[model samples]
Target: MAFTGRDKTWLRGPRAVGLLAAGAAVVLGLATGGTVTQAAPAKPKPTHTQIQLLSINDFHGNLAPNPATSSSGNVNGTPAGGAEYLATQLEMLRASAKAQGQETATVAAGDLIGASPLLSAAFHDEPTIEAMNEMGLDATSVGNHEFDEGWHELLRMQKGGCLNDGDGQNNQNSCPDPKNEFKGADFEYLSANVFYENTKKTLFRPYTVKKFKDGQKVAFIGMTLENTPNIVTKSGIAGLTFTDEVATANALVPELRKQGIESIVVLLHEGGFPSDPKAYNSCPGISGPVTEIAKNLDPAIDAVLTGHTHAAYNCSINDPANKPRLVTSASSFGKIVTEVRLSIDNATHDVDRLNTLANNKIVTQDVPKDPALTKLITKYQTLVAPIESKVIGHITTPTVVRTNDDSLESPLGNLIADAQLADTSAVTNGKTPVVAFMNPGGIRGDLASNGGAVTFGQAFTVQPFNNYLVSMDMTGTQIKALLEQQFSGLNGPEAPKFKVLQVAGITYTWNPAAAAGSKVVPGSIKIAGQPLVDSTTYRIVTNNFLSDGGDGFPAFTTATDKFFGGLDIDGFANYLTAHDPYTPVATDRISIGS
Candidate 1:
């Protein structure tokens, strides 16, 4: 139902920035007894003011359209995302609001860069910031990936510290490189909870107050995940700390209230739900972390816009009082945009009503591409084209590496395990890496060597997530305990499942017929042709994912004396490139014996 403003907040500003209205109320009518079947008169229209809040999240450096597919007589779908298309959509939305005398404001939740395709990553996220500026994004919360290049780089992206001087597109005079004439974005990056140790002040302003034409104030409080350091590279977040989201927001609420800002919106770099694999417009079966946060938030906050899960969901969750609090998340990869209309009580200066009008529209051919942005994209694409086209190696057949594929090790997993083992051995001072373990899930896609020669892009596809390599010390018993951790399963009908590990320099056989706790066959475990030595410790090499207990592997969390190498994929790529024109040397990384 369309929102009819009753007691709505109307703020006055130079321009009506973002005007959001509340949802409509249920009209009640009196009726006589005896099953009266008379049609009730329509309720009078509400006179409350309305406004539009336009938001996007988890864009993740998708400055161009992604490859899309449709089958079974599905409608024609174009590559969905592009800065030009997003700009067009925002402009059109703003125009519609202007016609209705409403205000519009655009914001993003975060994860603007990092783990991006080569196009954005190669330039250290400068391209993404440029695209975001062109698309007119006003502000965003810092995502974990924002720390991919570390806090200093994040600051540079925000303030154009790294761009060349005299870049015309941004603040013309402020560009770092005068000759190149590159521009920077004109937006604020907020971080309410992220802070430095000594000063204890937020890295950036905790929130920014956006004043509207009607003299109302809307405060956007932005923050990233509290466990950011755990997810991002440690060096990137040096001397920085992330506090709990709830604690941070709660602390800021009273301060915002003191400033006469009653309407509060949280732009957080986290989300809930997953989109249907068959359709980006809808999340078929997924509920993520955002719901939990929304449910527990203080009522002073009106709404929350979230991202990170890359799922789209438009649904209202109940508050503590059982009243509905509208919550929504649009899918990532620029697949869709979420528009929320909010209504605030004029007298109370609080959000009393809200209308959720989310349209996860497919960016199709019908929406003509913006020529200017397309040209910029082409320039960057050309720059990375050579790297993408370079032949890396060949895969004679499909090599699987999904964590939970099976008890048996996958060929790709074996290859990565060998690489890690060899690299770790080469690095140790005298003591060689006797064994190496690679997390299965870290190996994203398969190597279809039979199809054609593997290129850099193909290698990227094989191991997409930018996980780094780490070496840690573990006693022989600790290693066994780690292996045992993977064997343990959650106890329940719908318990969590575990993914198998791919190990090199070690061989172990497990019998499915054996009891759950005794699955490993006796005398079937060996490392470097020696019986497993419980008293001896070993130096192991693996990815950051395993070190962090991702994929339900808690054993890795116990690894000590950790060393963080650079990017894991870089290590793999360097290994492959050095051994050019490679072929798979299938070794029994794992063996299941009777």
Candidate 2:
């Protein structure tokens, strides 16, 4: 459940690490000793010193000041997610660890790349790679978007060390050769589960053994969702196969043991819990697959660091009633960093205890930007300024994108589906530019088209996740079956959250009382103003998220000839810019006639 971009500022920041200790400082009775001296209370017993695991997730290439809504009603103004603020935060956390006689590590779960704005995506993740290096990310998992440019491009980005100027400090790696250019990453990407099916080769080192100042070794295993094939373009992962996550972790545990490392932590690329903007303590209890995965995962592994849902949580999940296996996720877009402090048992070589601490600090502009990295960002920013600032088009009216809103369809959703159908049909070299479908979950935000002009950010508010346009061939019957899956609620009782689908090239009315496949109201199905041929195979364009079965659309999973390239947002923007000053007609793409 990638968080759709929005201005939900009312939700309070999730519970941060220090808040809990502040309240419990006295209530837990740490100040009182067994024998309290009458004069000025005797000093309390010392607490166990702990190592800090610092982490941030979904830092989507925000190298400059950006607008984000705070959990409070504050608009948060233009003040979040520059690498400089992150650096300041990390530095402060490190200083605290130094005072505590413990070690601190900075890390991220995933979304290190892809869906980035023009600044980073212009060079295909180079800017992000540079920023992450400056922020000192120790290790990261292979996020689904990491495969956006394909695996080969990722390899180049990872190996192509930091960019360098003539200072001789060599802040970045200079590409050795044009063809063999390699820019090495400050950290490694761990994908312990992704493997090549034909060659049986593991994609990357499954886990990294990071050492602390005190020589304590902790193994970090990184695994993205096993459903990567469904979310990413087929061409990007043609031969590679994604195995089951739990199965992969179970197999890797023994390997870590062989390496004399048993204090294992999983930096998994998955997240859960819908955060309430109003309450800091009321984190949406873990209800997604991630919580289940955390519970069923090999308990030998100590902590699970997760991302992708873009929500926030700070409590223990799935160990016992009160004692919990620590699981936490910082909200997306540099909103927060989760700090997990683990106390390792020296003799047993295991994580003796775990505590989750969250920091909901805004990545503000108050911090001075890193000179070297800022200069680098300025260089790229200059390069991309023209295209990024270009005025694409105008919207007739504001389009909303609340999943909880059960309207007929969203204006943004219609625009995106229209582009998918049009662009994919032109590329297929086909005569009948037939059907297009856009998953509702992919339309992230609403565009306020009135009283103001639309910019890149305004347009991106509608479609931001960077999903690629995927075209597949499916029989009319199969398409109907796919629609049935959306209505069945097989995903969950709230499966309705995933039920919205925008369609083009056809119109039909649905009835809740009718049988699943036959729910289409008779005489209501229309294709090109005629009747849909049930046996005819139709060419359909949709996002890769659904083509591979994201959001439980199994019907497209079996469809063939999946074509992918430009992102869904980009395609929509291209469509808008090309056909601007647009009308706001509903277009009657799909109708639910009672």
Candidate 3:
């Protein structure tokens, strides 16, 4: 549904912008039933309109409170998360703004639901979306994680409905109680850069103009990182085209201007990491894809709210015009909410960029909880408690760490890789897999065995993608090519270094400073204590994500004789159960240039 001329607030910029209209495109349209209500006319434009914009990102549905590590935040060492706590903080912030006679609206940079814990993933992320609806999210950009279950499922997430992808109901959301229907999101989802392959149209609304009461409005252009194709599953975005973020946002500036809109905010689902991870609101030595992107954005964009990197930073990045602009990210999970008070100059219909104040407010448990959110979380917790608490394994040690050494290998990754290798070996039927690799991003969290008990929920949280295992035959030469391909990064513009994969049943040395194709030292690779020969065929096993060429590893697609194994999480649990009182193996299979 294209935005129709219905009320004063229905200011759709152009017919070609392809903004999701409120009616026909029900799946991706706004939840006001395709219509926006009108606000009374203003007597006169004030000199300034101070509006509060509350933002969050990478909230992967941590309904329960999490430690500092899972959220990548610890302001002087404090825990965060718990939908109730997050909601209470936002509510309090918004109330304070209203008290000061300021309009308030909350938005997010995306990742509101993918890569979730067992509590949310078990119900197909319905609980997360519901929590968002209750928390009063106004709009957001679609992050890469949103495509984890594929595009159609994303549409279902926006337009409320139960998933029916059967087979144990993982993808299927057959609500046991019909009254608990998924009512969809009341907020809007903006994706200015995501387009269709054949039709060349946007997958969702490119931009949405949120009109407030005093003739003041702000246009939000939401877009994910253009490189989403490289990180996400090939099948999830099979026919979608993710354009360059800068180009896409720049082209839309003129369209937004035509609608008499001046104040602009980019709900960008891409961000950077600050040098100090604990400094939730300060940008010191910020570096990543977003820094470069923010510097090139059009000056028309006043503020850029970002995410995806999962790190928090409040930066005044210089735009192409060499003008300082607001760029912010509120860490990950429900830990922090970035508060930006934009003072718009009504006289000039422009943003007083210098006066904009933004900071990340920690969602500390010290505050009271939102009853609504507490109820919502409790309902789901009760439904999932049995499955979540069931003991799946045991561990001798109570502590596990995922922080990588110089080799980019960690105990958590090693455990996952070895588990994957072991699962394939158990079901090989004489075929036999010699090596297995696990992508770093797939290892969501460290499997801590606190209290020496491993719950099903903890295991599921470690491998939440529900990806299956795939065994394929690749010659030793192809195997080397696979390892070398990790350095290729992808077939596109240059990007940050690829994350090294965790390996089991293999050991090799590589020089990071060496030339791309020759990074691996010669005669250094060994599989099961046997030298790798270029001509010998070797069976390899990896998660389905890699076999489909995800995470920039195209070499995985070159393998032949593919056989689908069991689910990755299942295999991991089986391995843990098999090795009860399991102890994390030493991380020595990887070696760097040092």
Candidate 4:
């Protein structure tokens, strides 16, 4: 097989040495046979190359550490995460691997940015890209959030430049450092499945081949979830097409093999949720889209690193040939790093799957922080302090969290929905929204109060997408269809697992045992304490994301009289201000029964 591409090079030293050694052994055997008997030369040990893959996923620009007591700060009760700690962990792991005579490559699955805190998002995630470059990231796939600003911005992230709006865009500064222009990513942003519709070309390189000093090579294929368009803002990905993950990967196997690269790994932005959520190092009853993708992958692919479910699990799933293949995920927000070791047979250049081992390591804070990362954080903090510290409002509770109850409704989600409803209802001479819905995914963090006062930074962190609020008229029938969608085809076969939308000014009952499209109990939906009339038109509000049928809510797209309002975060801020010292609302809006 011929080696091609930029990294390709002839691997002749090892084979030539082996041939010379074999000839010498044959000559000695002939001489010994003609003379006195001599002990047969000991058989040579099989040659192998060791490689260490350090991986993280769904980092989401966590430049600062989550409070030690916060859920995002720890992994199974151990304090972890923060760009400083993550950088230190990666450096230490690489050093350890080097001591063991192994070559190391650092990689990520996706979601390195977007839906980020003010520190990173304020400057269009340039800080996050710089931090990732400093941490020695080799490559990463593009997550759905990466297209939040559109594919053009994603390209800018790869090939550096300031946004055309420049500084003070979106009320936040960009490329704040006058001396340093935004230099893009040092690592490759691989997008094997995403392509340009006009030219039929991949948005980024499909795969990248890395060569080691010992003449060994490994190919990494990266891709995001195929359902990206349905989840991301439709306008952002207007000219792109996301292909099927399984077919995209399997199709590349032959091409990679043609290049004589037998050792292959895939970095996928989709992942699975384990039944044992606390089992960060083990997969107990793991099931999701990733499970099926892994099972159907070409047997030639040695391992898979996944993300997007924000789960941490180390599992060995069966490949197409029914052979176990390593699959891992390092939970979101830089909380964990996965260490994978692969031993490749030098002669065949194929991975010894039986010897492959993987483990998920917490990015613990016990070690000293990486100074470079700390400096970078300090710079951004200094620049963002004024806006971040401004008081947004006060909350009666210590924290209004996004954690959902039995019916998947959260206090924070309810508050956000009410905010959107109130904002749209305040409009004069227009259709006033009677109710609102908020997707659980949009609530990124808790509303933590310091002495009952919440800061703009906290509010921004909680609702970072900056999605516009949209008010529309939906008939009672359409509303019911929207509710039924929660239990139907949002994710995959097991879609009933809490894709529920948080609601305000409405209450309804659902039957978990009922069929998917009929999960919502008939005649149970009520608006403003009145039974829903199938023909009555009700004004509803949601972020622009859902108005365009995002998150599998096609009912929102069919609504009439659509009106776009201000940013959702601004409405949330205004609501917080108007209802100072707000109390938590009961999550009894949605109920589950027979």
Candidate 5:
């Protein structure tokens, strides 16, 4: 998600290619691995050397075009996204590589599902797994979102079958169909960072080498961020241990080299944001977790394909020796596909690092939709029409999930937080919550005020985690500690910028210049327009995400007299229904000081 406006200032430093091809006037779409941007072709080699790596990340099971195109990309005012268009783009690129005698490998950087739109989530993301199989995905890293339903369920995604239970039992009983049982994913899922503490071994294969028909091989090392536990559900990572990302990849370098795999590519599920939103293809001044990881990686590793931040960049940042190496990411939801051309050396078996080039090409909808993917999406869409089309409520203005760069709060965050507080207050359970907080990451998409009315599908897309509302009692001081937790630990000064929270029944100002844990300004926190009393007990409410200390807020776990409410989505939808023609609350709740 895009942060504050100030980010654009420093973000302008990176100058990589960011060209976009506008879609056809009536159709609105584009695709490819075939370079529209060209360089002098290499002379014919005695061996088949060039390899085409095409990838996408954070797809979130988007099988149809999103209503708003802002997240899609600035393609001269045209629509983008859909499994059909993404498949067509992949096929076109694969075909182009085949014609040129270069082997093509399609892969992803994680978040292929989870936090998905209604249609895919309605079916436990089975449609997405099927779409990936049809698109020929070879391998992928497990992003934090992959564990939304816990690791076992993630494995279930790969080893598909139908759910025998009902709601609250197995992802809404979303599996199989009237005619067939769900088949597992055909591609491979790898994770080097996530491990089972008891066995002291990785949960999934750390790396997989794709051997070509020409006897040449390229190793794909995969892993999500080291901070997976901080951001995912507690049960999702119950017994698993997350390791340092750089160390994990570095440790595998020697092992991969021993296998005679000279062409090493790291497929990571961690990324950084770029300064320019339109600079989709280039990695100029790209900043985030991936930058440090890429520069520190052993030079033996040639390229880094990253995701999870949901930002797009085709950056050629430098390695430890300061040698320029490729780093690429496609914009999420299949808006673009990153294509990297790598030329392997003849005798050394190593990739010609200097010759590698990457681009983030938009998946425009002008081409013929891949027939099979279209059929797959159509079947699910047909099955989900009733839920997808039902009206949830009306929005006076579009509700956004993007956080403020300075304050961190977002329109959608505010809406969700207020909804939670209201959802509990109406029940008249003597233990009413005085305040509510919502994590910015949980607010997935903007609830577009299309024709001034919102649909169930639109609301579902915004809050798809299916998290339940949790009310807990804590002292006023404990509440302060909870707010303070938002700044440090995972989102420290040096880490990715802090995850600004959306709040209700509370207001506070923080100073960015202050030390990490002390960032929340003193005497600035208030609840219900009254000074916060440190010693007095006050009931607080938040989604299950925060109650479990997900995203670094551990104080929530310390609350006493805890109670669980209905599904968070239901609370949000109910809030919308109760507050018809709702105008979102202003974002003055969280302020910043110099």
Candidate 6:
């Protein structure tokens, strides 16, 4: 039977199905004409997609795990961290997210390398870069330490090439493997605020957009601390300008919005300190420069992942619109990973800020190590063994740590200050330095005596910056002004935050309760056991980083005469050799009074 168009429609309609079923109810008949009616179908559920962000900061090239007993080796009393273990943890985390139908991105705030252990640093951090690429880092911000070797070198790290400096330059062998030359980072390094002075162009891309298979997109804006110049070697960042973090970020919101990206995350290299440093997951009374920056950020920013203070905290800070936003930091050395979940509205293509959640997951050592990372680390360890294992000296104590006391002085700090002084004293020129000041921040790690024998590796870990020593002349009044500067304006907005200089061949009493500019007690300053004369010029020595006004000590820049010496690490190694079995120094040079 050939069916007409009307007959085809009737056959396909519910009338035909109802006739076949024999008891189905179908509505018929309207007032003016014959019609059929049926109920409407229900609507589908709204789509909400999940995005997982796995973040780490301040890794500092810790390819191998710290000894299980060391504080850095554990998180909340459980053994954690190492490239192998961290890789394994990240893989498992990604796998779990994949099973849950969530997309994943792994990112870092900053300091993935620089001031690294011998195994990584000896090859100019090539091994660390290789390992990171293997572990699949999506992106990272440029940290202050990234400028340790200058911006050009940082570019080399990004673009990939062999250093023009042949192997063995600066005691580092570049392109050690002829077969596998450095191929640079597979991940992008974003720097939103750092720009070349002449061109005013960002050193790298300002931000990056990651698109999912379903067409939703999120953007990441990365920047380091604005005060990077004050802490890093001035020469390294001479031609660049680092702008305000908040301003740079706010200005980009419109640009990102124009591109239809409503979800944004900032990977900032600055961080805050939690009241209880050991509470990895809770943010109790968190305060620092980062807090003010976070509070002032545009409400469009969904989350902020931070680092550089190396303190772990998970906080919900209120944005400019008085909306709570997720802010988090994982502890340094790959010990912890912050897992942040964002719920994206498919219809709006925007993050549902109210549904955001974050947590700090310890990279526990209980899991099996990633074979690939283990193989990479083993390759570098074998190459650095000769230099790393050679005994440099012996330490009497089990470990000369950098833990500061009430007076804000530490055993390692005192030891480094004395080493700089001793290294500079050999200058037969009549302008010998009378004192040496070491910024506490320069001492990166403790000198651990493994069975009482300290290897070159341990010493290198303590002072890995390889900064050169600089001796200069400063008047007694200027020195006092330097001391006053530590407790006041020069540091940062985080004032009243003290960075007391570790000193050698000098002593002074400071009034703890005194006013900001008067903390150094009058008539208490002394040099070489004699009262400091305001008119006398005293020769002082410090690392080039400080002499050029690093760590907020601008007073060092006002010195009269300057004499550059050997590398600070070499001097430290020489000092250890000269002392043989070194005893920990007493932190009694600086006295505190009521």
Best by lDDT: 4
Q: Model 6, range 1-594, lDDT digits (tens) per residue? A: 121221111000010100000000001111121111111221222477787888999998899998778788888789989999999999999899889888788889999988888888888788888888888888788899988888988998998999755666556788877888899988778888788885646887777777764677877788898889998998789898888888888877787788788888888999888888987876667787777887788878878889999888876666666666677889999999988777778888877765556778999998999999989998888888877887889889899999888888888988898899989533547778889999887888888878888888889989998788999889999999898877877653355368899999899888878887788889888999999988899989999999999888889899977888888888888888899899997888888985
Model 4, 1-594: lDDT tens digits are 232322333221110000000000000111111111112332322587878889998988889998878788898889999999999999999899989888788888989999988999888899999999899888787788899889999999999987655465454776887788998998888888887774547887777777886678888888898989999988889988888888888877787788889988888999888888898877778877887887788878888889999988876776677766778889999999998777788888887766566778999999999999999999999998887898978998999999988888899999998898889533535678888999988898889888999988889988999898888899999999899888887742467365899999899998878887888888889999899999999988899899889988999989988877888888998899999979998889999886
- The parts of candidate 4 lying over 4 Å away from their true place are 1-46, 164-166, 169-171, 424-429, 491-493, 591-594
Give me the runs in candidate 3 sitting further than 4 Å from their true place. Answer: 1-46, 68-73, 165-176, 424-430, 486-498, 512-515, 592-594
Our tally of clashes for model 2 stands at 17
Model 1 regions more than 4 Å off: 1-46, 70-79, 163-178, 181-184, 274-286, 354-356, 398-404, 408-410, 424-426, 444-451, 464-468, 484-502, 508-525, 544-567, 578-594
* TM-score, prediction 1: 0.79
509-565 per-residue lDDT for model 2 (tens digits): 776566555556776767667776778888777777677776767788888776665
Candidate 3: worst 10 consecutive residues by lDDT? 21-30
Ranking by lDDT: 4, 6, 3, 5, 1, 2
Across 174-207, the per-residue lDDT of candidate 5 in tens digits comes to 6536677788787778777777765546666676
Instruction: Return whichever of 3 and 5 wins on TM-score.
Output: 3
Off by over 4 Å in 5: 1-48, 73-78, 165-173, 395-411, 425-430, 449-451, 487-489, 492-498, 509-521, 581-594
Q: Once model 5 is optimally superposed onto the true structure by TM-score, how far is the C-alpha of residue 554 displaced, in angstroms?
A: 2.7
Residue ranges of candidate 6 with Cα displaced over 4 Å:
1-46, 164-166, 424-430, 490-497
Q: For model 1, what is the error of residue 559's alpha carbon versus the real structure, in angstroms, after optimal superposition?
A: 4.6
Residue 310, model 2: lDDT of 68
Model 4: colliding residue pairs = none
Q: What is the TM-score of each candidate against the true structure?
A: 0.79, 0.79, 0.88, 0.89, 0.86, 0.89
Q: Mind giving the per-residue lDDT tens digits that candidate 3 earns over 1-594?
A: 334221224343332453221100000001121111111222223578888889989998778787666444345578776789899999899899989888777888888988898878888788888898888887788999999888988888889877654623442234534677787776777777788875546877787786766688888787898878877877788888888888888888887788788988888888777777766666767777777787777878888888888787776776677766778888888788888877778776777776667777888888988999889888878878777787988888775567788888899898888899999533555788889989988988778664999988888878899888899888889889878776765722254556688899899988888877777788889999999999988888898788888888888888988888888888888889999878888878888863
